[model samples]
Target: MTLASRPAVVILSQASHALGRKIANAIDGDLHGASARTSEVDFAFDEAKAHLSYLFSTGRPIVAVMASGALIRILAPLLTDKFFEPAVVAVSDDGASVVPLLGGHRGGNDLARKIAAVLDGHAAVTTAGDLRFGVALDQPPRGYVLANPENAKAVMAELVAGASARLIGQASWLSNTRIPFAADGTVTLTVTDRPRTAAPLELVYHPKTLVLGMGCERHASTEEAIELARTALADSGLARESLSCVASIDVKADETAIHAVAGHFGVPARFFSAARLEEEAPRLKNPSDIVFAEVGCHGVAEGAALAGASPSGDLVFPKIKSKGATAAIACGPAPVDPDTVGRARGKLFVVGIGPGADQWRSPEVSTMVAASTDLVGYSLYLDLLGTLADGKIRHDFDLGKEEARVVHAMELAGEGKSVALVCSGDAGIYAMATLVFELFDKGGISDAASRIEVQVSPGISALQAAAARIGAPLGHDFCTISLSDLLTPWEHIQRRVKAAGEGDFVIAFYNPVSMKRRTQLAYARDKLLEYRPATTPVILATNLGRLGEHVRTVPLGELNVDDVDMLTVVVVGSSESRTVVTGDGKSWVYTPRGYSGKSDTGMSKEVSQ
Candidate 1:
């Protein structure tokens, strides 16, 4: 059970719309309606329980604006362990009462209080331990991980029954928590990051305060790095689970072993420049001239540890070495946030925005765009991003300056800024992704570009969007061929088109025709007509997934070169493809998947040329 980072409000009655809107506005949450009175609502749904179930399945905390009994009956079947379930609250339609029905300690109680304050109503929090004391032992504030949660019920009962408890370590969170601590009590509550087994009457809290600094030889095995890092932590009696991050020099930023160790420890891998590491050379226990000559830094492990340490922090454990790796530990005055201390190894994300539509965009693409500190692309593509490009340094180039745009984005990433190279459709399909790798292969890839991490996020390609809108014309085997002769020779394009037609595969033609190039669409249609019938369904999808989107099914013989342009995607159906007009009088084109031979399903209809 994962909690949604964003909250969602579900309304069941028209009377609750105003209250739902108020809660949504106050909580900065999305609204699912019971009516059409408010245009600002994110969505409107007719079935209240199913909509709530859908939002619940999305891992979002739900605030249902309905009777508490009704919400309880609907959510009863989906209930699981309280430890993992997301917060679910019930708010009255008139905003008079706020009740935390489930996950009261996890997040429901907090959400109920917030909603209650907004509605000027009282929160009915029913958690037993919270009423007796001010805090929930199982949910011990952020930055504190509760270990031995199974023992929470027994200890809380003991405390409520007037039994005393002992508090160990610096638990500042307990200052205002009113946990009924007794200095010499039998129930021990330890708040240190150490590998310790909790007794039946005890609880353990691990605080994220350790920063592990590591350096490894090129292509070192992940097992070697993990063993060496674990040994260092074991010798120093530090819990590996408390590690905040793994810090290293930027040159080792791409080191697989370092990332593997960080992953094993469930922490982020952070990197710093040679100059930043050199600033900590004076604090290094083992400074090396060879290291300085190779990486422009005197030390790696110790230097990186100190660099990530607090202003007054020191290396608790000096550099410890393995056959191919070195590890060190740093103690900070506060929790270590590696992001603030070191310059991250630069990152470049080649993202596809997917035909300028928000819904068509993938979550990974949205994440990459949001993580980017700078955006680089063609001016029109960048403009298509709309508000998603806000607060970023925009570097827009012309349509033809593909190389310049890619190089500039890579350089910015090399300079330690996260850069997004935006593309219109799928980045890997005739887009900037290939150009990036080509630059790397041609030795035009700069050293900084070489060190920078590159990731390609896929988008909804034009062919895919077109196929979906036109009802699975590409249901069978398919191939995509671009007819652009500016790069590839026209002879090669003709050969691919002919081969696809002969192979009985659905073909999606990109760059079918342009203002200057007119003969390619007609020529390709003539070649496909030889293998497929004249009445073969041809789908012309223009501006797919965007405003003014148009889709029409025509026959191969009737395809007009005058009607096709660069913005259009032409999908030519295979020999087995068929078209049908549904009961609503809407045309649907689909290719037989061959299950029709054994099954008695009526799936085929006649096609008109």
Candidate 2:
């Protein structure tokens, strides 16, 4: 398994915040600080141990700027399997000493060394194998998998005790290690692409040198495709861990069966254009004119395998077929790099950033934005991403051109790029998600755009934020109405306002007023007063979750248009809503759930008894 890329640098005291920032910047990680002591950080937490435990549970590598003993005590209970754990390193508050306390082979030693380089300190790595041989046998380098890990401990112990080992296959990484190698030795280290069994004093490593090319008919069964590929690998006597990637023609980039086969092998699915595959016609063992007439390529499975395995590679297995799928395999001269060979399937993420705070942003939204190659949204929405948008290619649009931004995002994703369409509040509620589906339903978009994957991630809305800032004015039923009337007709908006007022539903007005539009909020207040009392509470929350947040309440009779703007969300309480003043001279508002009626009935029954 690969190590987690982005680490989190955590600090307990304000004094360690500076050192944490330095380490975080060096590693391109997020900085988290104690909420009671530190102010300026990417994230703040109330308890250090709880936060650290949460980060660890989420598989986030941690670099804590604190005492080693304290971190050990806090995380001692969570020590399970060492191989699956994330790297944890503890650094002194003065940035002098660095120690890898957990996941030494998984990445803790390397992370501690990197942090020590930034601080000009030393990494205290106590692992015997790492300290003596400068490598971990169990944790092989990328593009190589250790077949038998249970025997690694015994082999390493023998090697550390002055036993000579013999190298069997082509392995440049083992040449640099501090291993005593001889022409004849008792201990053996074997590396190959073929399947092999290990002896008692042996460790077998498999290099990812094979590529599997696949093709399937439309709506083919995923099980059939996977079984065909697995049968081909087994018949050829090849290890599944030695497979580099699953490749096919670009037209099948969105094919479910092809992607499923890749997923089954835990490898990436890459695609090449038909023309690129046609160039390998001379090397294909099975080329057909009928296939060329159908797909513009002579052989999809064989051609893709040869092309993906590099020019000098050899096709080992040629054109094995099932009822609806074809599979082939090829061996390369060296380990293949899947990313440099073919294009990946495109993905579009419609993400809502909530209001503006990092704390309010959902974890899935953050992960989508970080994985995105391009970010498309309004200027203010892109600006809200702050440091997270640093390295991304940004496509900014003005406020009035909402359709233009969504189209640009879709077009970018069509070109095989991961695009994030940023939105404020919830993406599905008055956001770009509806427009995306509308484009798909209307049949006006390009074919590539239609084939690209789409995902919607939800976020906290402005109404929810406003309701939380004040007391729960939305305790009962509620509805939201946009008052701009730019795209919506004024008469339709007025009718909805009248209906909500008659139904006595709590109303939250979004897009209350722009600079050019006014008088809508005042008209809504007048209409609501006809059903509810004049003393009903009206909440005006401006800049929710942003820098200058403000929430206040007023009587419905006193509500006016001048008090609201585009940045505000206005909530009008129903007739049953009540406001109370606390001892601190602050007002809170909430709607009752009718528990008083139940109390009265219970008291009557007691009196009868």
Candidate 3:
């Protein structure tokens, strides 16, 4: 194996600084002591959880000199034996190697080989990989496919004891590594010291799996809570298959998300009782308490960690916030070797349909929604997307209840649950996308959270569909102005109209002429006439793309004040738009391509000759 791809080393020693640095660097690895710094001299085990978390999270190979045992003792209480991380080999200051401590297949044996080569010393690597090639899967490492990540520690433990292991679906590059496979096809394995009859059972592993669901009433987020849990589990040698559920704070244990996780992992969604979470809660620097209490736990990370560990392992209290935390499953004890696996990112998509109509939808939109695992939005919107929501989990809320929908979808995704947040019309056009981004920006989340990738799927707006049905009023660049005084003040709307008049932009009116806000649109149209031609074409599109649709074009000066309603979209064309004659003698309104003589530059022209 190339040295470049080799996992780096971490040297931890209380004294014997000279020997520690030399021995660790001989393997061409970084010396952890020189690379780390802490001003607080009284730093204890959990205090360094932040730094240790960074090292263990990398899944690298590790080696520790049998030091004041402070490094090992401080770390031992937190790691799990199951994950494939850095190999850990222990040695004495006298330069004598003793045990292949952590990461057996993927870590420990490598440490043994490096030590043996450095001082002409003996490395206590009794594993099959080291004994055979004196090279190992953790050394001249051959990456193996462990079906279940949970059995990694147990398998590594056996191999280091000189037990035989046969890997199935072993990748080709691993042929030279110590762990062997039968070239014939499926390889058999035996984890015990006594060899058993060569069979598939000797090597099969069932992966460890976890499901996390939490809320914070305190300082911790899903990220912080889960890392603490991961460290504890990694120290004990357990691996999680995947996190796959999140339930609302009020949802019963019998809820679908909860039960589904149980069926997936063959384990129950053990609740990290809300009260217990509150007791351990740290004071958050931001708006996290509301989220935590709403979801019932500080964060699902705690649940994920607890579930990842041995049933006997206790919950580890969390340390202070990481300075922009590192993504890690856990920092475990040094290993003889480890069995690392691949990572897949979770997903979330939010879609808006504009005012309402399929014709306004973009192709990029429907495709995204079709691929999502869960759907979230208002009940009416969900019903509108009936065909798409058929089998997926629907997180439904009331119409104006936008924040809850975004939070719920994000929470579900953070738990490693792929989900989608549904909106009406372009999500960024004032639906759910903005809310989605706000949640992420708050840093009110957890460490274990799989950050949800927020995507906005665009759809047809009432004006665009309306414009298409009546005339080319929107062909020229246009600005949309909403007359609703609920959000934008009446003064702001007036200022915008003044700007639109100066810019020569086609103007589309939303929330136009609502009964309660009768004067705004009238004031706006009068303002537009100040700069625009009195005959500027006004097309009122009502019920665009829906049953009972109607579109009418009138002169701006002739607009009937009483005819406008909230459902109507008022589109007033710019000065360049005009009425024209089609080849068939049918009359049509259009905003001409500036090069009207012949050589066209419009989108349609480019698409054609």
Clashes of 3: 62
Better of 2 and 3 by lDDT: 2
State which candidate has the highest TM-score.
Answer: 2
**Candidate 1 vs candidate 2: which has greater lDDT?**
2
> Residue-wise lDDT of candidate 3 within 1-609, one digit each (tens)?
222223333334345455555664466443343223311111112234455555566664555454526556655765765454456566666776546666666656656767767766777776654565444332322212234344434555655665554554323344445654453423344222111233423443222222233322233344454553344335434343322222212223223433343344333343333444444334212224544656554544343333233233233332223332211122212111111211123357777755534434453564455456688888867776644454568888986577767777877765545576777666776567877777777755543232444567777667667677765767768888888888788899899999998998888888888667788878988898898898888888776665567787788888876878866888887877786667887555667655555554575675575
lDDT of each: 0.83, 0.89, 0.53
| Per-residue C-alpha lDDT of model 1 across residues 1-609, encoded as one tens digit per residue | 112455778876566667887887777665666544433344556577787887776667889887889888988998778788878988887788999888787878988999999889999997877887778888877557787888888988888888877888877776456666778886878888788889999989887778889998999989999999989999989877667788998878778998899888877788888998898888889999998998999988888888887657778889999999999998776667656767667889999988977667775686577667899999988888765575679998998899998999988988778899999989999899998888878867677777788999999999899888878887779999998899999999989988998899999999999889999889999999999899999999999877789999999999999988779999999999999999999998999888656444334332211
Question: Residue-wise lDDT of candidate 2 within 1-609, one digit each (tens)?
Answer: 122467889998888878998998888777788988985666778899999999898888999998889999999999887777889999997888999999888778988999999999999999898988888888888889999888988999998999999999978889788888897877899998889989999999999999999989988999999999999999998999999999998888789999999999999888888899999999999998988999999999999999999999999999899999999999998888887778778789999999978778886787788778899999999999887786789999998898888888998987788999999999998899999999989866777777788999999999999988889899888899999798899999999999999999999999998898888888898899999999999999999899899999999999878988889999999999999889998789998765576788786775587
TM-score, prediction 3 = 0.46
Which of the predicted structures, 2 or 3, would earn the higher TM-score when compared with the native? Answer: 2
Segments in model 1 whose C-alpha atoms lie over 4 Å from true places: 1-71, 78-80, 89-101, 111-134, 161-166, 176-182, 185-188, 195-200, 343-425, 439-459, 475-477, 498-505, 526-537, 555-557, 574-609
TM of each candidate vs. truth: 0.79, 0.93, 0.46
Instruction: Extract clashing residue pairs from model 1.
Output: 4-59
User: Candidates ranked by lDDT, best first?
Assistant: 2, 1, 3
* lDDT score, candidate 3, position 604: 62
